[model samples]
Target: MNLYLLRHTQPDVAPGICYGQTDLGLAASFDAELQRIRAGLAEVHVDHVHSSPLQRCQRLAAALAAGKVHQDPRLMELDFGEWELQLWETIPRGLVEVWTEDYVQHAPPGGESFFDLQQRAISFFDEVSANNEDLLVVTHAGVIRALLAHALNMQLLDAFRLRVDYGSLSQLELQDGRVTVSAVNRRF
Candidate 1:
């Protein structure tokens, strides 16, 4: 089984802003980036295409799947809750510190913890992985990192160290009963 993870292209928002599950649109560079992503994936044989319902990912997924995408809420970005559209600098320093200290188990006010996101993401992954078909998931950085962490049994904190850049591609392959990470943050 081949699992391909692709993060959405740049969003049409300023840097330093917190946006998770906020449903933002793509940036002006989306066209070029999308073209690059399409070119990069031209060689893969995708049997299934799943994507987050957010516009950023939906657009890309639709393009890749030729409008035959399966939208899954579980693939959405982490719910930032009250911090959804707020600038990171504007969020309370104390709250930020607390969440950053142990984001895996700590939930932002009204939001879920990284562990919660992982549970949902893994559930979706497991369900689809049972088919043993090649999959293309257009999702967020958080979900990709969580999947990578789960596959490698790495410390949750260490997953944060893996940078999932916009429009980057990562892959996992399952052979026999073992899963191996074949790529991480690969750009065209």
Candidate 2:
């Protein structure tokens, strides 16, 4: 199985706002970025393409998916709920303390926890691994982090350490139930 995890192009969001699953559009200059990503992936011969339902990812997936574009809710970004659209720096100190102390345990009001995301990601991986074919996944930074955590056998909390840049590519290959991380955070 060859998995190509592609992070979406830049989003149209204010610098401090937390915009998970907000359905924001791409940045104005995304065309050039998309062209670069498409060109970088020209030789992959993708057999399947998957994406989160969010427009930011779906738009990019539609353009890159020469084979099939499948939307999976399990691939969506972690919902920030009350924190959505709020500047991180401006969040109340008490909330920040709670978040910092136990992000995996603390579910944002009406949202999801990091551990919840890990479970969803694990389920998605199980489905994908069964197919064992080349796949292109267009998704959010959080999805990429979850995928990396699964591939590298890292703790869910450790997922925060991985940096998934916009328009970057990460590759994971699986053979006979064994996994190998071929590359990560490769810019086009």
Candidate 3:
């Protein structure tokens, strides 16, 4: 099975703000971003295409999938609940410190833990792998990180060390219950 994990195009949100699972719009570069995405997919075809329900990802998936797409909530970014839209620096510094110390287990005031996100991603992967066919998923960066962590067998905290930029595609190969990363952050 091959997985093509694509992060959504740049979101229309303020920089330095925490907008996890907020359902934001794409930046003004939609045309250019779509072009790049098309260029990357010019040589690859997948059995199916899936996308997070959030508009940021859905918009891109809709364009790429040509009206046939599967929308899944499990592919959403980490839920930051109360932290959504709040500037990172404005969050209580002490709380940030505590969360940083054990981010894998720590959930924001009303959010979820990285472990939780990873579990959902693994579940989604499980479902997608059942067909043993190529799949393209347009989702958020957090979801990409979670999927990458599972594919690479890295700790949730260690997953943070990997940087997944917007409009990037990472490929993974799954066989005999093991995963191998074929590429990371491949952008056009």
Candidate 4:
């Protein structure tokens, strides 16, 4: 299985707003960014296309997948819960501090933690990665980072070290039951 991961373009939201499973739209630069992403993926053969249900990812996935995109909730971004749509600075500093100090286990007021996000993302990855097929997944940075961390056997804490830029592409190859990280954060 060869997995290609593409993060959505910059969301149509103001800077510093916390969004997760927020169903945000694409930015004005979406068309241009999609063109670049298409150009970058022109040579890559994709047999299956999957994406997060969020509109930001859906637009790109639909464009790239020729209208057939498998929307999976497991691939959605981390749920921000009470923090969704709130400016990061406006969220209680103490709450933010707690989450920042240990994000892996700490869940936002009504949301799941980073660890929770990893579990669902990795579960979806495991389910789809067992076959000898080329899979393209359009998802969020958090999901991409979690998958990368799993493939590389890196600690979850270190997953943040992997940079996943908007409109970036990453690749993972699985052969003989072993997975290899072919690329990471290749932006067009």
Candidate 5:
């Protein structure tokens, strides 16, 4: 099985806002982003398409798959809870410090921890790996990072160090019960 993980296009959010799981819209230049993504994926043939329910991801998935997109909450961005839509710098400095110290186990006031996101990513992987098909998943950067951690058996903290740019594509190949990463964050 081949997995194509594409982070959602640029979102229509303020420069420093935390909009994860906030259901934001696409940026004004989404069409150009779409064209770039399409050209980047032109040689790949996808048999299954999945997307996060967030409109930012959905818009790109719908555009790429021509309405043949399946929306799933498991693919949604990290649940930032109270931090959603808040300016990054405005978040309580101490609380941010606590989270940054060990984000894998720490949760925001009402949000989930990185562990929760990993569980969701694993669930999606388990379900998809059962089928023999090429898949294109339109999801968030955190979700992509989670999947990369799962595939590469990397520590959560190390996965956080990976750069998942908007509209970037990552590829993984699963064969004979083994998984190998072909790309990390390839932008068009």
Candidate 6:
């Protein structure tokens, strides 16, 4: 089975502001970016399209899939809660301390931890693999990181090592329960 992972286009959010599952919209310039993405994937025939429930991903997925978008909550970005719209530097000191010191175990107030995200992503991947079909997933950077970690068998806490830029594409192939990463962070 082939998996094509696509991170959403640039969001209409302020710089340095955290926005996870915040239902943000894409920038107006994203129309061109979406066109580029479509052109890049023009050759690979897509079988199914999935997206996070967030509006940012859903909107793009709908357009790309031509209204064939399927909602997958597991693909949602890690919840930021109180830090959802705060600048990184201005975040409460306790939140920063927890995030910097023990991100793996620390969930933001009313939000999810990296560990939590990893579990959800793994579950989602298992289901997708069982289906064994070509799939295009329009999701967030954190979800992309979790997928990378799952494919590579890296520690969940180390998901941050993967850097997925906006509108980037990653590919993975799964066969007989084995996963091989074909590409990562490719933008066209």
Estimated TM-score per prediction?
Answer: 0.98, 0.96, 0.96, 0.98, 0.97, 0.95
Candidate 6 positional error at 4, Å: 0.8
Mind giving the per-residue lDDT tens digits that candidate 2 earns over 91-123?
787887888788887877778888888789779
Error of 5 at 150 (Å): 1.3
Tens-place lDDT digits, model 6, residues 14-113:
8999879899988998889989988998898778999998888988888888547889999999998888888888887876887868777888888889
Q: Per-residue alpha-carbon lDDT of model 3 for 1-188, expressed as tens digits?
A: 89999999999998999988898998999889999889989888898899999999998998888558999999999898898999999999998899889878998899988889888988999988988999899998888888888888788789878889899999999999788998888888
Error of 2 at 187 (Å): 0.5
How big is the positional error of residue 119 in model 4, measured in Å on the Cα after superposition? Answer: 0.7
Clashes of each: 0, 0, 0, 0, 0, 0
Clashes of 3: 0
lDDT per residue (tens digit) for residues 1-188 in model 4: 89999999999999999999999988999999999999989999888899999999999999998658999999999998999999999999999999988999999999999999999998998899766789999999999999999999999988999999999999999989888999999999
Backbone clash pairs for candidate 6 read none
CA RMSD of each candidate after superposition: 0.9, 1.1, 1.0, 0.8, 0.9, 1.2
Worst 10 residues of 6 by lDDT: 95-104
Better of 4 and 6 by TM-score: 4
User: Which 10 consecutive positions of candidate 1 have the poorest summed lDDT?
Assistant: 60-69
Candidate with the greatest lDDT versus the true structure: 1
Segments in model 5 whose C-alpha atoms lie over 4 Å from true places = none
- lDDT tens readout by residue for model 5, 32-144: 99999999999999897999999999889988995479889999988889998999999999999999888899988899999899999889988998997899999999999
**Tens digit per residue, CA lDDT, model 1, 29-99:** 99999899999999999898999999999999999995479999999999989999999999999999999
**lDDT of every predicted structure (CA atoms):** 0.94, 0.88, 0.89, 0.93, 0.91, 0.88
